[model samples]
Target chain A: MGKRRTGTPTLEEVAAHAGVGRGTVSRVINNAAGVKESTRRTVQQAIEELGYVPNLAARSLAGRRADAVALVLTEPDWRQFAEPFFSEIVRSLGDALVDTGMQLLLTLVRSEGERQRFLEYARGGRVDGILLISVHAGDRLPDMLAEARLPTVLLGRRSGDEYVSYVDADNAGGARTAVAHLLERGRKTIATITGPLDMYAAQSRLRGYQDALALAGLRGTRSLVAEGDFTEESGRRAMAELLERHPEIDGVLAASDTTAVGALHALRAAGRRVPEDVAVIGFDDFPLAQSTKPRLTTVRQPLEEIGRAMVRLLIEEMEEPAVAWRHVILRTELVVRESS
Target chain B: MGKRRTGTPTLEEVAAHAGVGRGTVSRVINNAAGVKESTRRTVQQAIEELGYVPNLAARSLAGRRADAVALVLTEPDWRQFAEPFFSEIVRSLGDALVDTGMQLLLTLVRSEGERQRFLEYARGGRVDGILLISVHAGDRLPDMLAEARLPTVLLGRRSGDEYVSYVDADNAGGARTAVAHLLERGRKTIATITGPLDMYAAQSRLRGYQDALALAGLRGTRSLVAEGDFTEESGRRAMAELLERHPEIDGVLAASDTTAVGALHALRAAGRRVPEDVAVIGFDDFPLAQSTKPRLTTVRQPLEEIGRAMVRLLIEEMEEPAVAWRHVILRTELVVRESS
Candidate 1:
């Protein structure tokens, strides 16, 4: 083997070792798209062999001096701000960004003027990228940001036809597993409380619940479904509405843990014992799930992983404008507790 | 009265009417400090008469290109991130900034490298100002940023000798009220569980506990005290220790709602009935306070208002470097619930 150089390896040396032009090495290092996969692999290998570390400061200076990304939450209801899911995702995102040297700018746009100002600021090249969460259907901000070429990533899609990159938990699969668990427990009358149908996640989860029942040779009718806005109060009201219509629900699949908590309260008020009279399962397995009486059985999504994946995707998109629009859906685990 | 202008009033018109230099008019219009109160009022009256509105875009371009502020949290513990307090404050701050057209960048620094990088970023003029929260004693970041002439406002101070502008809740007064309530209930042996000593809020709460006892002619020794880290688990552990050492303790004051929940759990595990057996009071009336079994009586601090005030103070400092340093302490209310 040749004697190892004492100083940091230069781009020219890496290119020479990989037998490529200096520009090719630069593009590969910067994660620019359009390079052949094999060539990219070769350049990566050369970089690994030489241990070439890109100077982040120099790269940021050459690009834009602002080393910041915006984490925008588009929820109009401020009540949702208290959800444990928000804090969990934010903490995970902060942890993921610790090593990237990029700050997370948290902007909540509840008004049209604020929204317009944010879009203008983002488009003006003040922020390197954006990570938008809690987007509702028919929201134009995501499309506008993407159209402006502002390197945007959504936490979840507005619908199936989302054009921007996003990382989401497998909501449908989680709901399916929740219903299947209830079915295995010999629950004949299964009902579901869904989040607002305007969100794709809620719609997907409702679909999964229906699919699970159908797969089990059970019939799920419209009477067994109630709509919720994912708040505990809504869950309680929906549960109340369901009971008034069909009081024989032996099992329930709530779209979120907060809703499940409300369902638990409503069942207690109705003189029903958990798991014995009505088995209930929730999604998102937040801390409240464990704290709830009888300990709610819920589907645990990899929130931290989702956050890390979002940062990774946003970083990739920012580095290479040509990177394909990617959609990532992580799996969920069913944590069986006494509530189920 | 002068005839109403057909279009937007010019800065020159306001300056001429105010009978001051154009620079002085600009300073007053922008809310910049260092001008006498009388002169400032005169300029403001002139601007109001002319109905002049400074162009934000022009002001941003003429001043610093960046119109963003950093909200820094000093805690290295990720568990603290899940606290409801973080979400509430963040949402409120976002709401306050909605009309300002400025963005909030959240930077969580866990490691030394991340902390150094963030300090350098702020000192390098990448952001216009900073709002710091959860500050611990001897933390150098706030001092460093303030010394570097960056406009800084802290949610709570590191200690009583803090020189920076800050907005705090009446922690000591709240704790005293809690103890007084316990005294009114005829509980003699009142014990206190404190948050981390490094935090000013925690220390003030402890002081309040002692002062209340002293005022009531009840001796409060170190044996009646146990330390917590403002976490549920810490509260549980502290409650367990207090019970072991002073089984006769009849009243408990927890520094935070989360800690109170843990204390309640510990009391239950030990077969102690809430209120009837061992009365408990918690600080920060979070949602968890109401959800806890038998409910938790807590001190309700104006958390949202504190957030808004922090933003307001930071904006003032940013607009006027010579603004006098101000400290604000909002009052807390004693919320009676089943726990007490």
Candidate 2:
């Protein structure tokens, strides 16, 4: 990991071979940039001929590229990490970038101060590009970044339509499929537990459920519905509330795996057997799906695909700014286990 | 976000403030090596005042840092993301770096080629540093990274005196506390379902169990020990094995929350009531710990703290290379719930 090579090739030697500046030679080898046309080629050629591998430890002393990227989470609660969706997405993103010879940086922003500071840093060229995850609606970060026009990709779409690129799962379609499955199962007493509706994801999922129910000629039933904030407790509370309100409920749909977990707990506590007494289905096929006594019958969003798609979109936009902003929606598969 | 205060600030402001040549300003800001020391400072001061952030987004333009860090997870299974450990560590690491004005980049390198490519990207200045997690003993990536002298901080350490930095929990102490509590409860025929022992964390936990047994003059019995890989399915399998080997075992200890969940399933499947016929304890009190039927008595590693520590150490090392290689060991607490 150094500038050492056979024949003691100078920066000049490398530049001459690659037809670029000594600086360009340094930049490309160090994965830094700013060198002009044909410069990178010359430098790369020189390095290949001389078999020169840039030494990271020695590079700091040479006053060159630090060669690092930071990954910002932009979330606060520590418990948020336990969410399988987040971890799985990060894993896939990291794997893809690593193959590209890039590093994965992780950061979490809980407040406006941190957000501003991070934006400043990004503007300061502290990062090559940013991979952002924004949970709440109406967060003004996307526009700020867009105006800056930094190479940034978001986990979710901005609330409004100012130019930006993003990758998201087919949350609505997955929910519709989930609801359709329940309808096909012919559980007349269908019910639903939704996540925080403020989130576009939650809203899309809710819409999917409604569309499916409407197709089956079953209208929305308030007594058979409850709102959860995507936690097991909320799911449990919602399920218990549903049971209290409609004891005859035989089919249930939850927005997430955690909520479904809560549904399982509530149903079990109430002495209701799954699928037999009250059928259950969940989304996100989180790790918990299999551990439950009656394994969860759920929908699996292609997490790796989501991550790769986000990176792909970001890189595409970064390469060609004139390209129109794109929205990528991947499909989801319903995985049936014992519960349903 | 307005275009008036555009991302590319005035270079004249930088020149005026730095009190250097327009040529020197070009050299320093563009990262040319010929700029003198004093000239560099002036240009830097000017650049800072004008808020002249460098541009990395342009397809052809190049200068400045990547502003991201790569978090490498050595785990092979993508589904393992459901485990809270991956999420908690990632979130904490992300939180710590957010305000440090760095973007977070995350990657998973499960194969040799991928690991090599990541190392290349990192050494190539694609990232600033790396924070790694859940690496196994047999994996060569850790050793390769260390040999390359890449700036890396691990969530847990491997065997031997490698010079890499890390932040980890006091697994041994935590295990001792859990086991000691079980012993104090007067439950004999104790059994333990441990994570893969090849991992240093797992080994330390096993040592804790042995230490506790010895303190109580109870020789550690192989018959009561079964191995798990820190998943619910593994715990269930181990529990079943332990039951077959030691039918009269009345107490159980699991290395992780998932394992404990599996043990609960196994106990119930065998018609053994929790805390009545057999008591159990688990580790890493994830949110699910509270939701477990009888709840779960588990060890709570300051997962967030470890994340913070890893980032802190890596940043400190970056700022000052003279800092001693540190092994930051955080505390772990035993949170008792109904299972015990």
Question: What TM-score does prediction 2 earn?
Answer: 0.75
TM-score for all predictions? 0.70, 0.75
Worst 10 residues of 1 chain B by lDDT: B56-65
Best by TM-score: 2
Candidate 1 per-residue lDDT over residues B4-67, each given as its tens digit = 6433456788889999988999888667889999999999999888757554334443564357
lDDT at B70, model 2:
75
Model 1, range A149-215, lDDT digits (tens) per residue?
7788999899988879999889999999899999998999999999999999999999999999999
Candidate 2, residues A1-340, lDDT tens digits: the string is 8965432345567677766667667678667757665766656667878656554334432442233345566656656565666767777787667555445656656678877867766665545567777456767777787777776677766453535777778888999998899889888888889988767788888888888888989898767668998888899999999999999999898999989999999999999999899899999987779998799999898888888887777667656653577788789999999898
Instruction: Write one digit per residue (lDDT tens) for candidate 2, span B109-219.
Output: 767776776776665555667888887777777667666556678888776454578888999999999999999998888889998888888888888988999999999
Give the DockQ-based CAPRI class for model 1: incorrect
